[model samples]
Target: MAHRMTPPSRLLASVGLAAALAFGATACGDTSSDGPNGAADITIVTGFYPAQFLADSLLGDSGTNVDVVNLTPPGAEPHHLELTPDDVIRLAEADLVITLDGFQHAVDEAIEEARPAAVIDLAPAADLTTKAGSDGLDYHFWLDTTRYGRVASTLAERLTELIPAEADAIAANLATLLTTLDAVDTAYRDGLAACEQELIVTGHTAFGYLAQRYGLVERGIAGLEPEDEPSANALADLATLVNDNGVTTIFFETLTSPDIAKTLAAETGANTNVLDPIEGVSNDSRGGDYVAIMNSNLEALRAGLRCG
Candidate 1:
């Protein structure tokens, strides 16, 4: 299940073609006019679901008109998302494009080629942490509530800058979202502090931020890519670690196949459960939106770790 890595030359050529297609599409379907409400024309393009959720929450029911579009489809793995011609056209027309850098290479390239009016990259604002033993930054900052709160506040300020007329509403929504984020942070702290075990075994390294936040150790069978398959030695070592740590659960994600997790669980005599990475929402998700899915993840952690 390894992802096909696009070489630098091919990627550049693809970006060039996408830009040309985008320009042609824009020429035919140009609609940059403002809405009839006299509201500023604000079009938000997000790379994935988490960014989409944050942008939507920040612009909650405001009188100022805003159109937020998420490029990644529901239930799709976003790491290697290929941009469609229409998606490139949308990016080219965006007033503001929001993305987490390094999470989706296609979106990063599209934004570079499209050159939208404004771009808000959450990676730098979130002060993201890097995975241990890996030079790559952990792009999953939303897994840590405190870091995500910072990102949310930064997003609010950016939105205010973009649409000054809706500053008050954006500030109010920011306050509410911040409060909820704080509560989530507190819950993770309080719930995980008393856990009997602090070891988390997952199918991939998506939970590095979460494990770091909660002071737990994460043993990932694969790296950042969810579709990657672990080698035989890696699986054997993970099985041994699970038994040594007395781990009772092996965690899988919603967007990936559970077969590997089940196989590891069988080898280790442990049960398996879904510990979503919140990459995208799907019909299989325990709950909708970021908060609900995060709460569900907390519950899974508590149960898997035997928290008091």
Candidate 2:
């Protein structure tokens, strides 16, 4: 179905608290103010960085054709994204909303309350798989370029269907995006093909998809969620793996605490390095966008893993 939004009750449901909004006016038959063929503007609300990147690429300089709002701000941790009432209303009023559910509980709750006309959950398109042989699905599928591309395809198709007037432009954008993703996949394949150490450990289990994709083994100090504290047993086991495998680097990510990884590195006589998960973008990020950050991560891996 083409995306449309009737003025939501303008009420945000937040853990038993409520914020109500009243819209004095509504656009005539369209949520977008104006665009191609006199079609209304399209608004897209993204859950986080990965979703925002795809939406930005899909729009592809279709300036004013579409507006994208990301709930998770740059430099903030997506795992702890706290949404304002205004954020919920934006989601409710957006023509389309794209997100990976369960990754952020607050965003998930907002989506349910906002009830956007069109919502694309990237999880299904991603075909999420478990990591470390655990029963829970790893939500960091974007770290795998192949999985990211699949979600991109889904978004392009949905957006085109929702806004036929912009289909041609969107298709062109998708082609370019697919090409970029393919190139990224190739780089990872070639970069990690051979390494001094295949046991790439990180601050968290965020790199399971990337490690699996490239046939590199990944172990994390934290569990799937960055905030999960590893038990003494888990830390000891990881230290053993580090020593036994002669691992030279202990990797940490941009958006989370580095103390644990740094501490482990000190304990194990390994160097601390960044292996970003690309969940959000900020000045501190090695690269400004997804592709650049992925390339930076590749360099980090190559250097840390001592890849030839």
Candidate 3:
């Protein structure tokens, strides 16, 4: 899928906002309204789309009386996301704040400042691997369906603690979500087992966990940060690896620039396709939600790897 890069000026603005938020310049405001049926008003503030999706699923529709808000806007990159003043206030007054800590500096600072009633950091909930050449934890564990299911189960348990009266409902929703996730896991394991090739060349290291889960090798041109530019030598090395591995496609993500992938593909005579990290939704996303997009990713991998 074609995606326009976040403009330089917009990125700069986001950085500026992050700086301002770090200094506590943003003013706090009121929290969300009370919950339905006289339950405690549960305001869930998430750092990005995946957490938000999980919260929404667990909480059910608006009738569930939980307010779910994702700090990262739709179609925006979750990394380096800037928290608006309104977001700061919401975080301050939220009942539960869920995030993949270390993924975004702005969100980390906001959570520290806000100090909500309860916080669930998905990074610790799920087993995390370190990015290559970096000591920091990889915060994109949600890409692996099984690991994501673990996180969801943990989140449901936490939500039950927050709202004891709704524990049964929360548990039921979690079971449904887990069943779907298991299906995805089965599909991935079965589909990738007999692939023609196990080497995946991606634009970034976001898929490390996914690759690890399914016993595939991932050669990421860039590190954890999608916007990081590749060195000339690194690009040349990636091109050589792609050609040596007989990689049919170079995978790019939905939110990052595909220029590097295109460049390497052009040099290696390979094609380019999207392997969504599902960090956030986009206007041109292959699927509307996590399950749909994941299925699409499965099909892409089957085709790209020549699975039998």
lDDT to native, each model:
0.82, 0.82, 0.80
Q: State candidate 1's TM-score.
A: 0.88
Give per-model TM-scores.
Answer: 0.88, 0.88, 0.86
What's the lDDT for residue 235 in model 2?
85
How would the candidate models be sorted by lDDT, starting from the highest?
Answer: 1, 2, 3
Evaluated at residue 292, the lDDT of candidate 1 is: 95
* 1 against 3, candidate with superior lDDT: 1
Model 1 has an lDDT value of 0.82
Worst 10 residues of 2 by lDDT: 19-28
lDDT of 1 at 56: 86
lDDT of 3 by residue, 1-308 (tens): 11123334432445543454444432322223334344345678888899988988887843356778888878888887988766765676577899887888888887776565678888877888886667767888888888889999999988888888888888888999999999999999999999998999886778888998898988887788787788999999988888888998999988888888999999999998898889888887899999999999999999999999
Looking at model 1, residue 267 earns an lDDT score of 92
Clashes of 3: 0
